[model samples]
Target: MTELDKKINQHFGGKVVRKDLTKLVKGNAIVPTYVLEYLLGQYCATDDEETIYQGVETVKNIISKHFVHRDEAQMIKSTVREKGTHRIIDKIAVKLNDRKDQYEASFANLGLNKIPIGDSVIKEHKKLLSSGVWCILSLAYYPSDEKDASPWIIENIKPIQVSNVDIDEYKDIRKKFSKEEWIDLLMQSIGLNPKEFTLRSKLLQLTRLVPFVENNYNLIELGPKGTGKSHIYSEMSPHGILISGGEVSKAKLFVNNSSGEIGLVGYWDVVAYDEFAGKTKKSDRGLVDIMKNYMANKSFSRGTQVYGASASMVFVGNTDHSVPHMIKHSNLFDALPKDYYDTAFLDRMHAYVPGWEVQKLRNEMFSSDYGFIVDYLAEILKGLRKDDKTNEYAKYFKLSDSITTRDKTSIAKTFAGLLKVIYPHGELNEQEAKELLDFSIENRKRVKQQLQKMDETFEEVDFSYERISDGKRTVIETLEVLEYGVPATKKTLISDESSVKSEGKNVAEDVPFELEGGQKIIRDNQKGISYDMLLGAYLIGATDIKIIDPYVRLPYQLRNFMEFAKLVTEKKEPGVEVKLHLVTNNNEDYVENAKEAFEQMAYSLEALGILFSYEFDENIHDRSIIMNNDWKIILGRGLDIWQKTGAGTILTNMCKNNDCAKHVK
Candidate 1:
């Protein structure tokens, strides 16, 4: 176990289980992750390898014996009948048989329906009245023959989830971990490796949890397939349900007028629609209208009766075209069905997570470390829904006046959801609050910007905030806007200075390259930057340059140095030699390799009419570049600033073969 894993075990003992165990014990059973983890939590919530191994085997045995599979339903039924009574784990939903004045249970995987159930059981687990709940129950067969009589009997049932959690204790324990550590812990709980995601990417993953904790908070994410957009809603929590986008109706989602029963929104905390995109997919216009009203008002009316529900809405889909293609030819919501393309319905969304920014899943991305069993976390989130942290940002900053009330509400709900996820204890500094505020504004801004492109009446508003401490205003922009909508004069292409319009109507050319000396604060997960755009203007006319960085001994660090050197060569006059020197820290392990690499770089650069030299400084810590042309550039991360693309290459400005701008600030 790593140090973080050990710390997690020490602080959250018996509450956290190795996340990878869920997949290990899950063979052919189609159950939510919480059910399997609940079983594992009872046995494997320990760091000891021997205990974990034993626990995994025990859980596997339980699953093999008790968990119902559709293909083996008849066999299990026979076993139950022969044994008189048998314990089984299956998804069970209850519905009131009004005519008989009794409740009936339907076992989803066991393939049994209309089994008589106790009234007390229905009262205890009311959620069973809506979508099915995974439960461990006893089934008996009486083999009786009577008019309108059923032999199947359910003796007892227990929902498969953490029964209860001391939310106060959970909040108090949260104080032990730092912000980054807590974020990593949450990431692991969702079966993701924190090391594989940038801070921005981590926030995007956490944003999916917002709908679970915030009432009526609508969210949408559309991107390329296989990004795990619907995985969280489907597998992470029993309180949420994932359904086909094209299969919903007013009666199914709102209230069933035929039976006068409350629908899914009345039971689940979140209702996520999977595969919600495709322009040609047919949809019920009445369903869309009801959804629009419910999403905006948190209530739906049936006849003259008004019903309210707090279920947040989530829509996850795949984009048919790339982000740039959508930005050029259509809007970011181009893939949404024609009925759902209305600006009014789209405006109900509180956040638009850029699923395109998320890297596709790989084997190594699954966590092997300790994290809260998701059921425990899900319950905690459900508990947090009672507390409103929407005004948390008001302590540090005020949003711009130009932001409308509805936009502010959307931003506040998103901010509150993120705060409840990251800082549940409500302890945060100004910078932390500011980060969440900016991120919140950016997400809502993405929705609004796309709305403007789709509809003409929607006026553009400045997505900026003013700090209470110094009154400094900061404007936030979505990554897509920065990549595609930059002014023509600021275009960074060296090959073609001409700027092309989105509609291919006109072009602007001959803009002079401009540079100013000031601190450039790049937001996290920002893209559309390159070595040329970052340092070319500053390094122009520099004959003698000395780069001072403390740690550049790693192979990837050396690659960054070489890329910078190549940029320098390309920028300088073809025939004139530019002298370059490096002052970096020495490492005993890689000092020999560094010397060899520097010698090879010197040999290569000398032929290009450039002088290169290097020296190790054990005591130097500052990173900067000093040039003889009276220019000094301070480096926050040295030359290794670009983020790693999923394709295993550095993403600077844009992808090598695609138009993805991926980087961390």
Candidate 2:
């Protein structure tokens, strides 16, 4: 096992199972992931290889013997009749039969209904009253001759979930893992491999869990298909239910006035609408109005009475156009039906997830390591719903007053949900708090930005915050704004001397820029930035330049190095040859190739009136560029800031050495 897997097992023993085990024992059994994992947690929640192997067989046997498959329902019923009683796993829902004054149960897969169940069982698991709950139970078959008697009986029913959890213990054990490790553990618990995602991408995945943990949190995600946007609501938790978008009505979702029975909102923690996007899809105006009210106020009225519910609403759908295309031609909500496209209805949404940023699922993205039995994680998240972290960021920063109360509430709920998911123990530093705060603002800002485009009445608000200690205001922008926004042409000089600095000032006169000495962090996947934008101004007046980067041996690394050299040549004087030296390292596999590439680069640059020299340094680790002008520029990712793109693409052109499309302000 990997060290992280071992550590996870060491701390969360008996509560975590190998994530891949769900698919192993789930052959032909159409069950939710929580149902399968609940069974796996019983026998396979161990890291030992032999125990896991035996447990897989044991779970498979149990599934084969008890779990009902619709194709074999008659055979299972025959077995139950012959044996007089049989145990099975199936989705069971209960409804009160007012005429008979008794509650009746329905087995979803067994195709049986109106079987009488005792009131005691209904009180024990009230969730069965609203929707079907996956349960393990025994059914007894009896031949009765009475006029209104039923032959099938439900006995000893148990919902497929952990009965209880000590939330304090969960919070206590959470302190053992660092924030990154804990995030990874949570990612694996959701059946995703964390190694395949960036920190930003990981946070995006975890944001899907906020609705499950926060009350009345309204979220929507529209993107390309196969990104697993609706998978969490369907597979990760029994507390949440995924329903077809077209299948919803006021009666099915809110309440049936005639029957006076509450709908899904009264029982489930979250109700997610799947396949919710299509411009041609028809929707009821009454249902949309009720949804807007419920999403904003957590209350809905079907009759004269007002009923409140805590269920969070989630909408996941597929977008027809690419992000840039939608941004250029229309707003992001263009795929929604005409009724749902209303600014008033969309304004109730707390956050809009950029589903386009999520990478499509690949085979290697599924986790095989140990993670929480999803039910256990679900229980913990449900327990955390009561704890509020709305004021958590106030300790470090204060938001702008221009933000509306609705926007603030949305940002707070998202921030609080993320905090509960990652730091249930309530321990956090300023940097961590800033990350969550910025992400929360960006999510809500995305919603508001689209609203502004759709409706001119909606005014733009400043989504910026100020630090309490230093009063440094930080502005937040969605990734799409940075990726697709207009190109920046000029850069403001930072030095007190506004006049030009000499050596190559005239060469870069058309593209004026400047730099100051400070550390800057660029987020991954952020595009339209080039090496020239960052180091060009700093390298303008230097006669001799030395770059110390230990990793310039790979093909991509060499490409990045050449790009930096090109930037230097662009910012050099017309006749003077600036001496450029590179101190990089080589390995056994690429040493010869590295030398050849460096020789070729030197020969090429010599003709451009720039003297290029390079040497190998095996032990040099830190990356920096030292110039003769007494300025040293440090690099965290060297010259490889630009992500690779297809040849001759717009991104490739915009991110080349001389392009200054996106600049750091």
Candidate 3:
């Protein structure tokens, strides 16, 4: 077992299971992951090989016998009728039969209805009244002679979730894992390989959990699709519900005035709206107004009654346009439905997760190692909802007075949620606190900055914080504003000065250059810079160039290296050879493929009188280009800095236009 596996097994013991085991036992089963994990948690939540093998067989047999498949529903029903009594797994929803003066149940895939259910079961599982719950039910087949009489009689029912979690034991075990270990554990639990993501990317993944832990937290993520924006809400937690954006209504989300019944917000810890961004999609203005009020005040009025709910709201959708295009031609909220595009509604959002920063979901990103059973972790987050640690950062840093109360509140809530996710022990040093604080400030600032482009009345505020230790102030800017050109705002002078200072560069006639102690900061989706502009001055008179970046194995990355080679060849003497050595990690699955591609490229480069060679170094993480001329340049995202585009498109060339690629520093 790996060290992580050993540590998880030691600390969590039977409460954890290997994440891959769920997929192994879940063959052709159309149930949600939580249901599969719940069954695995019961029988296979251990590291012992023999016991796990036995548990796997037992779980497989149970699923094959009981789990209902729509295609085999008739066969299963026939089996139940032949056996007289049988247990089955299906999504069962219950409703009050006002005419019969009793509660009735419906099996979603089994094509059965009006199965008499008792008041006790309805009271125990209230969720059945709304969307429904997956449950294991025992049924008896009683053939009736009467035409209207139903044959399937309910015997016993159990919801597919842990009955209870020992919160105290969970907290004690959490203390055993260090902060980094805990972060990795959470990432693995979410089915992501922690090693593949940077600290910022990992934090972005964890930020998706904020709504689960923070009450009434309002979050939105708008970017290209396939980033798993709604995955967590749909599969990871039983306490959260994911609904389609277009399907939601005032009656379903808030309260039904006719029935006087509360909606999803009153039941689930989180109510996430999927596909929330579509300009032409229709939406009710009344629902948007109620959502805005609830997002800000945590309460909404329905006729004479005022209802309050603690469920956090999350909106996840795909943006058709790139971040730069939206920023230049329209506001970031451009893709949102007209009613939801209101400035007041946007202002109520606590944080806008930069979905563009999150990498697309790749198969290699999934973990094969052990992680906390997601249901168990979900319970822990739910338990932590009552704890208020928003003021923890205040002990080490102070927000700028220019930040409004609403802005501070949003920042504080985001910071607190992240702290709880990463540091459940409530302990963090100054630097760690600063990292989270700055991240929180930047996310809120993204919302505020975009608000300025949409509404002229909103003032630009300095999103900076002061460290209490030495009273040092650090300015925070949205990654978009820094990388892209400054937004055309009335406060252009102040924005320009802050942008220059933030990059640690001296501005001379619109050209920015690094001063003695300054370093360039590149923002995602920013444009207008080329490889020649970035590295030309440093590469002058350099004969031998060495590039070290482990991720140069991908096709796009290798293409980027070749493009950089073009720059080198353009600067070199006609016949003089400039040796370029590449040091990158050998991706085990693609090593042979990468080597072949590199060899072909090397053969091509030989014709240009540029000697190119490559080697694999497993220990390399930092990306840099070191020249024999003593000029070393560091890269944040390495050479593959351009956004992915359609093949054969003009934008395929990185240097074709300044805006063709993402910002690189």
Each model's TM-score? 0.93, 0.88, 0.80
The parts of candidate 2 lying over 4 Å away from their true place are 486-521, 532-543, 550-559, 562-580, 584-622, 629-632, 640-665
lDDT of 1: 0.84
Q: Give me the candidate number with maximum TM-score.
A: 1
Rank by lDDT, descending?
A: 2, 1, 3
**What overall lDDT, based on C-alpha atoms, would model 3 receive against the true structure?**
0.81
* Model 3 Cα lDDT, one tens digit per residue, 357-394: 88899888888899888888888899889889899999
Badly placed stretches (over 4 Å) of model 1 are: 486-514, 643-665
Better of 2 and 3 by TM-score: 2
Better of 2 and 3 by lDDT: 2
Q: Is candidate 1 or candidate 3 better by lDDT?
A: 1
- Report the C-alpha displacement of residue 405, candidate 3, in angstroms: 1.6
Candidate 2, residue 528: the lDDT equals 48
